[model samples]
Target: MLLLPLHSHGQFQTPLGVAQGQLPQFRAAPPNTPANEPIGGWRILPRLNVVETFSDNVRLQPEALQRSDFVTQINPGLVVTGVGTRYSVNIDYTMNNLIYANLSNFNRIRHQLNAMGTAELIKDFFFVDGRAVMTQQNATLFGAQGVNNINVTGNRQNVNIYNISPYIRYRFQDIATTELRYTRNMVSSSSNALFNSQADAYQASLNSGTAFSTVQWGFNYSHQAVHYERTNRTVEFERSIGNLRYMVTPRFGLTATGGYERNTFLSIRGSPSSPTWTVGFIWEPSQRTSIAFNAGQRFYGDTYSAVATHRTRMTVWDLNYDENITTFNQQAGMSGGFNIGNSLAQLMAAQNPSMSPEAIQQSAQALLGLGLQGSFFDPNNFFSNRLFLQKRLQASVAMNGIRNTFILRGFDMRRKAFSPEGVDSGLIGAGNAALLNNTRQTGVNALWSYRLSQLTRANIDLTYTRFAFLAVDRVDNLGLARVSLVRQLPQLLPNMIGMLEVRHNMRQSNQPGLSYHENAVVGTLSMSF
Candidate 1:
């Protein structure tokens, strides 16, 4: 059946259909404090924000505590426009500091400055767009350890990322649009406590279509180079993605996607390639119900632990219902990946190692536990399909009217694991590490917002997630919970906007106080002309 998800947003007006344009973010903003800027010939926005946070969990739950953080930002941009002058430039500066009161003890100071520019050129109906940004992430954390787990030894990682890219596009008078783009990213985690990596990729593609009746097609080429000395490993990879979308009508659409990737091991690696293909459809039988189906195949190459190749097949289905302007979506699917190869036990026995009889038996047991292994992502997992419900309402407060919004999203999925031989020994190691026999996971996310006034607002966001999976013996379960509260003061003071936020995180496992928790507060003042 054909599916067309009914959306009140007047169809998907994604920016890819329009020229290059975006909003600005501060060059200097305290941690978790956001700075926004406009990218185009038009830049006119007044802004102010403040953020701060404190926590006392350090003594009770080291992992769940945050000592303090503060940030302040200020920025404005210049818009350049004309036939050949469709460019925008924005500049920002930031100052921030933090302290982590713990046995390891931590203190930090940061100063950042940034400049961003975007260009959109239209020549004789042909179009081209590009962006250039430069940033310096500098920080001084007392007594190094560079955010390390241990309390001793000082470690610091400094990174300077420079990004510059330009794309050329061709917009057919009445047919399609094609573009070519290139990007480079690198991070030098030289500090003893951090992981360093480097990567770069390029993409070339074409998109053809219009709403109601249209199609999209493209080919992408990319390369990823990475080195993690801390992990004692390296990987070199190349990947390609190609796909197409066909919209038969306003109420029905079909899409097909195909991709392939190959990775060469620099230190310890496995199969060099993986390929996947998928086709799906969307049908909107009525304004109240939506339906969808997808079928695909995936190959997950085994590197560290695999006796042979592993391939997975996937199938998915989804249904949705709406009433009173409220909508709900649900989905289900099945998928699995597996691989079989020569008996690993034979390989182990073939080797000659000097060891005691008991040691030999233990080693033999580890080999026998491997059996046939499987490794790959199950695309059919229900989590890929979710139900999101949302509504808008108006309210009255303190002599002024306000608007409120509410949203909820949920997902669940179960998957299989590879053989014990293919498992990473880290989590279970000497204690008995083996591939998961089966795994199940479920998650729910919620959001609520209230506009107290034209200049002041409040928001609450929360998420709850649970996990259940296989082990050599019985099933293991885990859960995570997170909550955040935010207050927006666009006019905390004239020409200044401030944002304050606090968050709490809890995880369920044998470990109670090892969960991640953070709190941040920041403020910004901006003046635009």
Candidate 2:
């Protein structure tokens, strides 16, 4: 089990698909609120949005059988935020009602929610964190992907995740700091209920205090047990580690770690219990640049991890690589990966240090409303039921200018099954388990945003992704492009915004019945009070 600190409102990593560049239909803050000052109590904002879309390939079918149609969407939403002495909360919920002109049978309503809260119960010793998320995702990478909930693709499925954690922290007199935490989490899917699961995790850690400046040491332990509803099976993971760090200089350090891990799973190899060890180094020459690299040995085999980051006045660069043994339920419930909204906000804040947090958040939301954000290439974990060994590499750079902003991101991910097949089935049946046994995905995304004026902005986004099934000798390539214009309607209403967008989507594949092309135009009007 990997123990990561839980945040109050961490960003959620979601999968990217064709035509995913559509703008979010909600505003960040109310018009009368002050950007520089924080709110004292809870404030609720209600909003309504109407969208009309026309697509030449509404069904994403081949050119010979393509059809066109109009999709009308009416969405009502709410946003709530609060900050108090000991607690803070944030919530966003939307109910979408869709009506299709030519495909009325496919019309449906969907719900979306993202909420999180944190409270300090004992001043400085005890704290609690909670989060709930309801969203849609593609059920399988082999199926046709939908851009949003409005699409009629059978691949779309609703996913719900809930987590709550409580922890205690204490300090020994000038010696060390200790923390103990317990977490409970649940994950469920509407269409793929066979993969539903619940897990309980416990963790404890102790680290040296300021007394040990040159030589620091730490101890950590974690345990987790997961229960699957369909299989009526339970899996357990336990790990313990002790680490030491010696500062060679003010800016460089050497580190060593030794650990033991045990797990209950059907491994193709021998028993999955082993002693783990790693040697690493950390370098931080300045506040704006840092790098960390580690090489380790685990039950699976050789393991490696690296993280490097650099920041400038107008640009930010990040690179990360890691190999781990994880399950879909754990990744969806706890892992905090790359999120475009949070990345944009960080870039904007870095570029304009004088801007307030609320101002930077609003600016990022405005850019997102103009379809200026690009999705990162995340690993596909939507259809897996067993544990897997995953290795992923990702890098991104963002640059902000007086009149333009640019973001570029690339990723490569590979996965191999560790648990035996046919024991439990995911969305894919046991007969077709080979598709998920060994897989790889590689992709790149680029986005450009230009400020036309104080009230209007233009954006261009491009993305390319490739999926490979190593066992089946199948591969697919998907490409997407979007151009959009957004403007604030202060003359019409103080809280209104309007947008127009055009998109193109195409897919090429070695597998039959998986190739298609689409063109779409969308117009939206949103108002909040």
Tell me the tens digit of each residue's lDDT in model 1 across 1-529.
0011100011100110001111011222223322222233233232222222333332213453434322222222322222226655544333333344343234544433344555665553333333232222112211111111111122223333344556677767546666776655444322333334444446677665453246656666666554443465555567677877687887687878789866654211224357866677766666534555556654432111111111111111221221110001011100112201121112222232332222222222221111101011111121101111111111111111124433344444444432232223432233432323344545554444455544444556565555444443333222222232222222442223333444443334433333433332322222322
- State how far residue 128 of model 1 sits from its true place (Å): 8.2
Instruction: Evaluate model 2: give its TM-score.
Output: 0.90
Residue lDDT tens for model 2, 32-144: 56531235576666667778889898877878988899999887777777778999897878777889999999999888788899999999899999999987777777776
For residue 44, give model 2's deviation from the true position in Å. Answer: 1.1
If candidate 2 were superposed on the true structure by all CA atoms, what would the RMSD be?
A: 6.2
TM-score of decoy 1: 0.48
